[model samples]
Target chain A: MTWQPELDELRAREAEARKLGGADKIARQHAGGRLTVRERIEGVVDPGSFHEVGAIAGQAEYAPDGTLKRLTPSNCVMGRAQVDGRPVVVVGDDFTVRGGSADATIREKPIMAERMAHDLRLPIIRIIEGSGGGGSVKTIETTGRANLPGGVGGTQLYHYTGANLSVVPVVGLGLGSVAGLGAARLAASHYSVMTKETSAMFVAGPPVVKRLGEDLTKQELGGWEIQTKAGAVDHAVESEAEAFDCARRFLSYLPASVHALPPVTTPTDDPARREEKLFTHIPRDRRRVYQMRPIINAVVDQGSFFEMGRMFGRSIITGLARLNGKPVALMASDPFFYGGSWTADACAKIIRFVDLAETFHLPVVYLQDCPGFMVGLAAEKAATIRLGVRAMAAVNQTTVPWCTMIIRNAFGVAGVVHQPANRYSPRYAWLSARWGSLPLEGGIEAAYAADMAEAEDPAAKLAEIEERLNRLRSPFRTAEAFWVEEIIDPRDTRRLLCEFADLAWPLLTPAPSGLRMRP
Target chain B: MAESPITIRAEIGASVWKILATPGAAVGEEEPILILESMKMEIPVVAPHDGVVVEILVAEGQQVEEGQAVATFRR
Candidate 1:
């Protein structure tokens, strides 16, 4: 191919367009421990594959003397690219120019990116930083009037987030201070991530909060720790690279958009491979706590568990794991915290995780060791019952294949709720299943009061009652009644779950028509 | 012959306020090892049996009924 003059001219134009803020601004952005908007897009997409849209479209200013005053285009960038060869549309906020304020959000920038993704059936990754299309104070000054709510280009951002929940996978990366509409953008995505040191998300920054008479640092208001632990953001990473990597990993388990099924990879582990360690993972002493993470790792693929909302619900762990190379939603009770008692916060987390799994057509794998719901004045005040019922309802409504393994301590009504309803109940198994109305320690004293009082030594009499009840509470008693399907050895969990994965694989061939929106 | 032990029903029916001992907090027979509050009054939950506290069923601020075992001791 010969180098034509028009082709060379166009190349120069593209280079000029990229140098929007000049070299000084670009270097300053690098010096401040931040990536330029274009650099971030490059970091997320496969190298040299991004085909940018609307590069030449920007604002043109004229002076009173009929000469050019300044040239400023849209303070946002939009393009199409591939992540690991999977096509996706990307939108980034150019913060170096006008702080990416809403006034500079050109009409076609958001619409082009959103509509293209929607029409082309591709996932959209939005690299949002700064105000991210929110109206700034200077905008009102420049326009000589306040922009009406939902006015021109007002609902564009809303439509972008709304489409993600319904038709496509939207991932938001919080790389800087995300406030107002920016924070909403971060939350509205299916998966969101933030850099621990550099990113913060809040309804309003410290300036607005300070004016309201409360002094707070930006980190105190909405740092990565606060957001991730509060369930505002799904994951937090130590670096921007890790945040991007997290987003890529999350999308791997989900479809490019809502209309497709998640891609399946070949299984590397044998379906019948069993790890004997699970048999003794739970301690014989009920009061002692054991680490639940290892049990989760042992059951899933050797190194395939990717946890979400980990810190928020300390009592429950939710994540994505591959069983025989098939993606499954993994939920487990963390016995270390509050004795694995589900609290109001933990209930909310369960509901959210279940909804996501059901909507995405992912089968659920529950490693249950729940003692039941947390009870107290604090629980009641927090409306634990209402939240608990909602969690139960979410689990009940899910149509996906579910498999529950009772590791230990399935007691009380909350424990019963872990199993699905009788008709569409999941394939249930018990590994040392121990179920009852309550633990015997508390029940023995009340039931045997008369017998204890009549004995010569009341204290000694109570001990005899406890000893008898302990014998009755054994898992062998429950197994004799056939209450649980089978009491397999702990090491058999991996093999059993892999078998369930094979059984459930036939169900994933067809996409469900009515995909529930994640709650 | 043994005298009948008094049945100590909770004066305030509520969840556990706080469990003061593990399975083995040395407690005098009449000493309060746990506290339960219901309505508005702070109800002192006392040791029903004297010995080494063998098992504490509930943790701090756990819910308990009028006659729930907050702890068990070997006399």
Candidate 2:
């Protein structure tokens, strides 16, 4: 009388989908020592907080009596879940079912997951194991159809991928071999994590690429090593548990969505705790190189400087660090590496890192110690100037609050990328700062190359030329012109940065920016 | 577990101004292990981690080329 039979039928179909390609496939997944889709969600989010939707959207087989038969679930399982008590939409790949391919590609599952994150104004976590919502060559055979690449309403995914960059934090966790659309989703994220032991992300799998005759495993081709170095992925971990922990930690620094201000933790380190070592840390001697890392550590909140892509761009250091426990994106030039010059790789790193800071509304703190763009035949061949200009464009486009502390040697075009162009920096300060068309040594050598060649005592003439130019290159001379804003005691940097953070807080937009952010 | 060694290298051609680390001495990450004077600038070869100095390869006043090993740290 109550239609209990139909309700029971609904339960039966859900149970079938939950089995995930039946006992055989689930066993294989376990044999691989991997968690299923539901398990990943369980491990990633709070206990018993997962409220799933579209659970039985897979194709169904019916019996003669019209009762439900075996079912195949859509490989994508999307739902609302709580990660550390805040709501986030979790879209996972159920690899046990059709290898997490779009065999029963109910396209709405992924689109809805994305739309849910945007509509609900919550952060989205993608647990991508395979091409769950992605395409494959075999899709033409499976669905008996073919289509153009990212064409015809591909704009749907584009809207979220671009919009969410400024609207909400999108985190991607690549846990297995990810291809096609899977690779796109991973790269689209503001932050990405991969499991070193199991995860691989690429446009196509090794088999499709076998024609090249490169016998490489999935990891060898697109593992964390390759992707992270390429700046396609942000972080890597030894296990899925560690990856989840990183995701949670990263979210803790950001708001659930851009509609809210980024969370600010109470400072455990004193805002006015002057690092006395800094007094002598950056030696007054212009020719000596001191480690930039120590000065950074001293100024930032203890244990809060989380560096990103350290090895890829050695000259420029980019990371998220807390000043007075307020998160800020920090970029500093390391004097030891190429004299803190910007190379093509460093320029690319800047583009990505600045995009990250702008998308998430983090104020940028640039420790500008650049000696300028890398020069010589190598630099020209690498298109250093072209990419440096592109980097300048990225900096110019960023609307975030930026403060630059010119430490030393801000010489050429690369130095200008420290802050937004055509605008006064909110709080631009200098410490042991030096700036000009070029450093005295290099400038003199190049400009007086002919003069030195013509002089009989070339060495003496060069020395005299450098002595005459040296006075103009002094940082104090630039300050006298009022070109530089302020020269402060190095020890006071921590206090000043804290003040700037508080000052910049009110300027941050408390809602999704009206515009969009592209990767 | 034994602390793996991290080698400290000279990033530019310079004459070693001073040796800041001694065997078994405690050092903080980014603290200078040695100072190299080049281009009229003083550059510090710093430790990469909180560790004890394990060995010193170059002596004070020694000339070292770029990427030359200067010291090692057990971190």
- Alpha-carbon deviation at A415 in model 2, angstroms: 1.4
Where does candidate 1 stray beyond 4 Å? A1-13, A62-71, A425-430, A443-462, A509-515, B1-75
lDDT tens digits, residues A1-519, model 1? Answer: 677976775665566668766678778777767788888999998999899998867776678996544556576888899998899999988777776666777856877798888778788888888886547888778989987766776686577666556667788899888888778878887778988888889989999999999899989999987898788888888888887788788878877765677777888877777777776776675655567899898878878899988877677999898998889999998865566778888898898888777777788999888877877677799898899998888888877788888887787767877766744544445555677786665566677778877899987878887787778867777668876667777777788898888788787644543654652
- Which ranges of candidate 2 are over 4 A from the true structure? A1-6, A150-155, A283-290, A427-431, A511-515, B1-75
Q: What's the CA error at residue B27 for candidate 2, in Å?
A: 14
Local accuracy of candidate 2 as per-residue lDDT tens digits, A342-408? 9888898898888778777888998888878987666799899898998999888887789888877
Measured with C-alpha atoms, the lDDT of residue A51 in candidate 2 is 91
Query: Which candidate number has the best lDDT?
Result: 2
DockQ of each: 0.03, 0.32
